[model samples]
Target: MTAAVRSTQQVFNLPDLGEGLTEAEIVAWRVAVGDVVEVDQPVVEVETAKAVVDVPCPYAGRVVALHGSPGELRPVGQPLITVAPLDDGADDAGRAGAGGADDPGGEPAGHAVYREEERAGSGNVLVGYGTGHGPAGRRRRRVGAARAGTGRRAAADDTAASTAALPEGHPTGTGAPVPTGAPAVVGDASAYRSRLDGELDAPLVISPLVRRLARERGIDLSAIRGSGPGGMIRRADLDARTGGPAGDGRGAGLAAVPDLRPAATAAATDAGADAGADEIVIPLRGVRKTIADKLSRSRREIPEVTIWVDVDATGLLATRAAINAAQPDRPVSLLALLARICVAGLRRYPQLNARVDGERGEIVQSGRIHLGIAAQTERGLLVPVLADVQRMDTGALSAALAETTAQARAGTLPPARLTGGTFTLNNYGVFGVDGSTPIINHPEAALLGIGRIVDKPWVVDGALAVRKVAEISLTFDHRVCDGGVAGGFLRFVADCVESPAVLIANV
Candidate 1:
């Protein structure tokens, strides 16, 4: 009778979500267990610190398991899903025997299955992970008949001997042999033992990130037993051994530090405990946590100064009205006009449109303007960038702004569009606010804030009259330039608002 071989399962880990984001919250799963999925099909929706993105599965197979549920955080390179190839139909005994003396190459049957699937895997690369192309006419070979008396250990020994026999630069089961001392990436639990039995003493680890975590924390992989399938070491294993939180990789290093702060007095402690009972604690995570970290870093690193000026926006509003009247189908917004004015100001004072490279002790001035429009969404505040704003006219800017704002509010903007801004333009006027000293988006030099354009008594042509006036505040990094340059930029913007002819003349 033919012995049955265990089906090889491929675990698809969460790929890096770009910009060095370490983890992502599983927003939703498109496929359930036992459901068939095709290569490049989106299996899950994940929200990174930057944006909500659909993660595509590289393997086309029946999903055996989903690693994380909605709202749970999964670290990059951690398993997101486990898929069993539809073509696999063998048991453990047959797999073991196939790797014995009967096979010339002595490679385990499971490794062959993995290689075949990978060769035909998804061509679409997700941020940082994907499989390579294989030959067009290569056909998959079936596992040979089981060699008698060859159990798991014998098969392991044969596989290890075969690996050792191969000379340097020769391909192993999966194209190239894993570099010595590096973690072995085994897809199947059955092959995990065989890989560990090889000449190398590396741990059975599939994720580079998990290995990096262990390396960073000075944790010995061989010492800690793996909690994952087939004794594969996972990040949780290291975290558990060190007594740190699953997400935090610092281990016990921080825990060992002594707390030198004076303890609260008995009465104060009692009062604080009573007050804490009524205090609600909301965890800062996802976009909120990201925003908090960035804002905190900006506050710590940037020496910022805020300067405000009340401008007569009557002409700006009138100009917007005239443009809309001319092109009724393409009505330009007040925010777009202000964006144009800001662009003009930036062109005049290029120093304000730059970032400080503190480490390099230099200011990097950008030749192009990538304008970030601050839009408050249900998720949080998002700044979708409009690349090369210097090349776009008022009409194009208006249309692009509307589309980007819509995408932001609907939470549909991609991760790439949410970054790379040289400057930011915030319209707090929508919230009926007069003015706000907005925080400068970190790395960028300045943020321009616009207040509501409302009817107010203003001195126009040396006479008091009710006019459409607004407050504009410029919060800039003091490191980039002095008040003279900042004041000049703000004055230019105000001039454009008071008389559109100034902007037209510059244009």
Candidate 2:
């Protein structure tokens, strides 16, 4: 044989997937220690700014270690995985231009990147290391774009570009990019401004989707400013600039432009959503990308089996109220009760709490249950796991739910909090939904959809009895379970919800 193709490890630090995204909530990891990964393979999923994203592994190798678990917030540039170089401990092999006088990774073997742009007359960069005591006023060319290999906090420091890295001489201000038609004097350029779209300039940092939206709406993206990181273009930026109901001032879907008016009735006859309405366009990055990838995978790869049921939740609600009163100060939600019920249900239908080893063509069933609570936030959807749900009581489940929601909203949830969920509980009831077919979170077998509880008249015993009723939908993996089993599992859930004491006895 000629020789082994030697390669070095590139600890691909997390890039700013979200526009000017400084941080992300780690949703899940696809690879584990000792698993071989191919380049471009989705290694991790994260949620950011209302969207989820999947980060593809840049290098192929065996995963040596993972930094954390799901729901954990990892800052940009943090090491997510450690890959063994193809060279196998040969430091000299495959090493490139990563050396710097002071590189934080201490690799001293990275590519050379111009950290600061040289302005026509400006002496140096705003931060340290750019200042040199030489020619009284020797200027540097601010023509080149800044090199960003790590997380750079892009603020609305210059112009309203959400993710703009300021020009050495550009007046400091945050609003929108130089109006769409503004001085096309410069090419599609970017640096680090965090108004909104600044951090999203992958390779070149241009918001292609946002520009496309603007063009389609008959509004020039350049004309509309940004209000996000580095002054990047945001949905609101476009909405405000276009006035409202964009284009013809009519309400429309994500594809329709915003109406120039604020009255809801103004665009009543339009397609849908304020597509071009009061909104700023943010290109999906980081967590948002992760979310998209996971959801896409779940919808695409697995054959989801959805089953719906309408249950009288009157008893469940009353039990919850009484339990809360008994444990005063510790509120218990219907979900807590549902969670306890689902955990117990899994005891009878173990397949729903299992994973498919596609590689081995075998199904791996888990005796213990890890419950994932589908959390909705301003950013997007996050399902932080309630590990060992089979073991927790209603009170413990209540505490976990409260803590998880609080941490999720605070943007302080840990990766561990978001991982290890074998079964997912999605409550669409909060939105008054009667029933819905939810997608299954893949690698796992099932996701339980909870619908709104309403006062519906039902004929019980003999006469008509008005009671609070809730709807539930169970979506499972057909490969791991059949309709008969899935239906039985859901019925078990309904029974527990109707009879609250079963949960206590099961525990």
Every candidate's lDDT: 0.69, 0.58
Which stretches in model 2 have alpha-carbon errors above 4 Å? 1-282, 502-505
- Model 1 / residue 321 / CA error / Å: 1.4
Q: Can you write out model 2's per-residue Cα lDDT over 305-382, one digit (the tens) per residue?
A: 788888878878889888778978888877787887887788878989998888999999998888888876544567
Q: What's each prediction's TM-score?
A: 0.63, 0.51
The pairs that clash in candidate 1 are: 4-91, 5-90, 5-91, 6-90, 6-91, 6-92
How big is the positional error of residue 95 in model 2, measured in Å on the Cα after superposition?
Answer: 35
Q: Give me the runs in candidate 1 sitting further than 4 Å from their true place.
A: 1-6, 86-119, 125-277
Tens digit of per-residue lDDT, candidate 1, span 1-507: 142312367788988676788999876565545345667666776778877656778787656678876668999999999876656544322433565544432334433322234336755645213323221101111111122232223333434433443333334533454332211222232334334334244455654345556655677887877775445576558667765443344566766553222211222232334334454344578777888888899999999999999999998889989999999998998889989999999999999899999899999999999999998875678888999999999999999999899767655576778789999999988777899988889989999999888999998779999999899999999988999999999999999999999999997
RMSD versus native structure for model 2: 15.5
